[model samples]
Target: MKKFLFLLVMSFSLMLILAGCSGSSEDSQAGGDEANSEGSTEIEFWTMQLKPTFTDYIEGVIADFEEENPNITVKWVDVPWGDMEKKILSAVSSETAPDVANLNPQFASQLAELDALVNMDEAVPAEEKEQFFEGIWKSNSFDGKTFGVPWYLSSQVSMYNNNILEEAGLTGEDVPTKYADVLDFSKKIKEETGQYAFFPSIDGSHLLETMVTMGVELTNEDMTKATFNTAEGKESFQFFVDMYENELIPREVLTEGHGKAVDMYQAGQLAVLSSGPQFLNTVNENAPDIYEATEIAPIITGKTGLMNVAAMNLVVPKQSDKQDAAVKFSLFITNAENQVEFDKIVPILPSIETALEDPYFNELPESPSPEEEARIISAEQLKNSEVLIPPMKNYSDLQKAMTDALQAAMLGEMSIDEALADAEQKWNKALQ
Candidate 1:
């Protein structure tokens, strides 16, 4: 039954990929012919929301790339974040897709499952592949094949309020390193400092990511059935329920989001905020006083002892006739030198080993600012971090199911077991 559902889902998605390509395919082929006749291959490259801000940087990269690969010309396009999926889908359906595109795992998995993406393992050289971080590289893979090259990445870091912690008779050294410890610290913070230790945002994908970090297997081996109602899932999820019931954590956590958490942290209501280092800028800009009192620490861990990581990857569509040029351009853009240069323009860390070793990540000033400290701490955590959500075609749906179940359990409308069991059933039905 599961196998049949998997096939049905794949069929639907493949149809989505090939939906309107007939005429566009012919036009694309003719364009390729014209380019070939002119002794060059023109491959369109699209990036998500990296426009005007990084225009100079991207243009420079393109200029250097075109200079090096005289036979290839990259046609660059920047799509807004809100429109990227629709744009990519339309391009894929019409066979007018860019040869290379920037995408996260959730959407990239959609293309990967349809066999619409080039296998990076076959396209990228083994030695070159070794240069990327293992965890990030794995995110771009499905089954046994890699479909994308990992680019920049970010890992959550602990941004704790030093003043609040000190009021609770704790120091940075005493900050929580595990979820259980977070509970203990929350209880203590409430008792002593009258501030919540952390606001665990359930509105985003954090809850599921937390479960995965705790070694919860969200699905069966083949990802055809839901399997998150087991001992591990129950134990991990129960912690939140118990915390919410006791009012140890903020009640708003049940309905609020990262923005609320950030506002609370800046208002001195949260003892710690586990988020990407980028939030430090918000604190520094919005609440300089709180920013002054903030200190950095590694993200809280679980049974796996690793933090959650996310990356933007570059992929080549299977329909492109310029696979070699596309892969070459992908590599050139993500190579250590280029990545390091790009990092100078942004706050993200590089996926390449050599790029990570650059002085920007390693050499700290005698007295680093909060931003510098956050980046360094975050960069260090990348080695022990991974994208918690594994590639699944229905990943967004599964997350919705799990989130709804957890919310119900927390609201006292259903027993934890009942909630989880219902969620698992719904997830299975969705799979079908």
Candidate 2:
């Protein structure tokens, strides 16, 4: 009987051991599933003022990217344009910046200066970098490092009112193609129709870009000192001073910004509107009659014959753990296929060379709208355009100096020479 009891106990002990092993295997399988879940990465992307307007489009893009990259997910956040700078700076300070951000070169440069952005030169492959326009691609680069990838570009196009032209006894051929002719054209319009030709706002960097287009160099070699206080610079400043004094441009130009120009154009007070083609939609919605009478032309240029190209770029923060994934998304969004689609939605030109070659940009409908014609004109001029004022350190302060000096000259507070000299002094101080 004692021998039988001992064998029975041994058998029960063996059964318990087998059960324990089975449980251990099941636990291991569950842990493996958890690891797989943890392996998938989710990245945050931030865009400026593209939420409600581009929600469906951006969401679809995210969906497509995720479908292809099954292990990665994208979380998109849209910030208001005015709020982006503060928000991005705050995020960077907290080390909680988004994995990717849509920013302009000027703003991105600030982060790049702080070493908070990824070195795109090393991250982007040569073949991929070659896909964008050389000028547009370099717009985001400074100090031998590229911080962002070019996405969308806007080259200014002159939108004139056909009714105003006819009222002024001017034909389409009479529109000015260069700055020298614009003054004469403005005089004709003011005399014939009693309407201002256009408003060249001295606000922000508009005047600075105008001077650059007029062949006034802003800085010397190595950018260590001011160089725009020369003969050409004085001439450029005097041109606007003459306009303001002669009542050719409205007095409101002294106090208002580009928005006032648009308002006046839509209201039929101004004859010409120099702005992006995308703005035609606003005119169409707000003032259908003005929209109907709108005519498109290539932007007026100065001696250099170069147009100003404004670009929006995509950037990855250095703090992002998923740098590769963020860059992949950036390239995917700005690729030829995607950029072409975006161009269709908005009249802005694509930065990608192949995207610009797409038939959509080159070809127009049989009866194209003013916006469509403007798109074509803008695209045709893109090859000759560049970011006139490339990103620079203390660029805003530099612009403000020029603006204040220009305002002083325009208001008769100082002579053109004094204004330029003052601007040079301020710029030199800022450079230091």
Candidate 3:
């Protein structure tokens, strides 16, 4: 399954590279046609899986942008989240790629590596760039060049079950704010209440980011080699190994993903859940009793005090004829004023500094729900949060290598030293 998933991702990346090559001539022709045409210019825009729910809000933004710039017409397309990679590659291959598209840093980095994206550092003025949070804005940067503009961000917050805490003879104040105390807390909850404290899955990039939060340097300055085979890396790897071997965490975490964690949390099988505020709504809908018992706290971090931030970004394709107009639209949508409005519709935090300063994020009602409290706490952590696992070439491969090694160690298939050495070797090969 791992090999198949890796190959599937590689195939998609290959398609993107080939698409950039085949569409060059057509892109030049399109640019020529746009230049020769009248003053009117229509640019295509694409967003991911935001239809029906956010239709009115997005359409209103488009209407506002077009009204402000009469010469530039905007065409908005909403693509399903699961189909975005394949569909975007197909559009690029056919020279039908949108002028501006919403993408995460990982996907945008692949395009940036191929020189298929415009350098936002050169296109967007420095003064305009200062309006966004530095850490969030830097998420889209690659090799000293900015490839995308920062958009809405989601930072993890610790949500605990008040019922479970009381059952375990603990209180809300006993909730851990550092990873160093999580193991002990988990042990206490398991021993007293016969329930797991949390599920720390190694299935995806979660482990990688956790290691970084624990102060494990993933790579050298230029990212040319692996640098995580040190004492800190071994300690971080052993943290999970000890948990699993001692049965402090669920056994299914070895194979299952984060969804399983959410399920466990909803069923009251888990005491603490570290996830975004958006998930609180799902818990409320599916498990109202548990939702009522849910209490919000700051995300648990390591000694570095850094939190994890998942962000969406906007990028302008290099092949687009309307590069300038695309950048303008990207900026306009992600600007302070626009981002604050979007926050009204959803619980996500804005990337813009001034937008984050909005009372919507800072101010809470006298009787705010758990979701509202979670949002406020999440927003407060944005200054310290970042894309912990920054975008890099072969990022997925590196993540897989580390995860496999950790799993091997936890299962007693390999010693901790052997696992780290093996993963370090694999990472160096991929980096080379």
Point to the candidate with the largest TM-score: 3
> Which residue pairs come into collision in candidate 3?
none
Cα distance off (Å), candidate 3, residue 213:
0.7
lDDT of 3 at 16: 59
How good is model 3 by TM-score? 0.94
lDDT (tens digit, per residue) of candidate 2 on 36-117? 3568878899999997988988998899899998888899999998888767766665557788999999878866765667
Total colliding residue pairs, candidate 2: 0
Output the lDDT of residue 346, model 2: 75
Instruction: Give per-residue CA lDDT, model 3, range 187-231, as digits (tens).
Output: 999999999999987777799889998999999988999999999
Candidate 2 backbone collisions, by pair? none
RMSD of each: 4.0, 16.0, 2.7
Ranking by TM-score: 3, 1, 2
Candidate 1 lDDT, 164-243, residue by residue in tens: 99999999999988886777788899999878998888765788889988888888877778888899999988988989
Superposed by TM-score, candidate 3 places the C-alpha of residue 19 at a distance from the truth, in angstroms, of: 9.3
Task: Provide the overall lDDT of each model, using Cα atoms, as 2-decimal numbers.
Answer: 0.84, 0.84, 0.87
Q: What clash pairs does model 1 have? A: none
Question: TM-score for all predictions?
Answer: 0.91, 0.90, 0.94
